[model samples]
Target: MPLVHIDLIEGRSEEQLRQMVRDVTDAIVKNTGAPAEHVHVVLNEMKKNHYSVGGVLKSDEK
Candidate 1:
């Protein structure tokens, strides 16, 4: 089984997230020769305040 985890900031449309999962899963299946049913993808949405870069929170940057 292959497990992929993706983390991103919130606010993406449902379709975008769905497409992302599909594309990522497809890529993993193609690259790793994994079965579609055995490939698992998990998406984690983080609050702006929970992420930071360059000493600034994402919420503050925006």
Candidate 2:
């Protein structure tokens, strides 16, 4: 089994997230010969205020 973890800032539509996971799974299957059912994808969405860069929170930037 192959496990893939993806982290992104919150706000994407449900459909977009679903498509992202599907695309990831397809790539894994194509490259590693993993079965579709054996590939696991985990998506972690972070709030803008919870993510930061250059000492500034993303929510504070814009």
Candidate 3:
């Protein structure tokens, strides 16, 4: 089994997330020859305030 973990700042629509997982699964299957059913995708969505870059929180970005 192949496991993929994706983390993103929370803002994307459900359809976008779904499409991303599908595309990722396809890529994994094509590259590793793993069955689609055996590919696992885990998505972690963090609140903007919970994410930071260069000491600035995403929610505080101007």
| Highest lDDT against the true fold, candidate | 3
- TM-score of every prediction relative to native: 0.93, 0.96, 0.98
State the lDDT of candidate 1 residue by residue for 1-62, as single tens digits. 99999999999999999999999999999999998899999999999999999989999984
Tens-place lDDT per residue, model 2, 1-62, is 99999999999999999999999999999999989999999999999999999999999996
Q: For each candidate, how many residue pairs have backbone atoms clashing (under 3 Å)?
A: 0, 0, 0
lDDT tens readout by residue for model 3, 1-62 = 99999999999999999999999999999999999999999999999999999999999999
Those runs of model 1 whose alpha carbons end farther than 4 Å from true positions after fitting are none
Question: Which of the two candidates, 2 or 3, achieves a greater TM-score against the reference?
Answer: 3
TM-score of 2: 0.96
Cα deviation of 47 in candidate 2 (Å)?
A: 0.6
Model 3 Cα RMSD, 1 decimal: 0.3
Q: Cα RMSD to native, each candidate?
A: 0.8, 0.5, 0.3
**lDDT, each prediction:** 0.94, 0.96, 0.99
- lDDT minimum window of 10 residues, candidate 3: 3-12
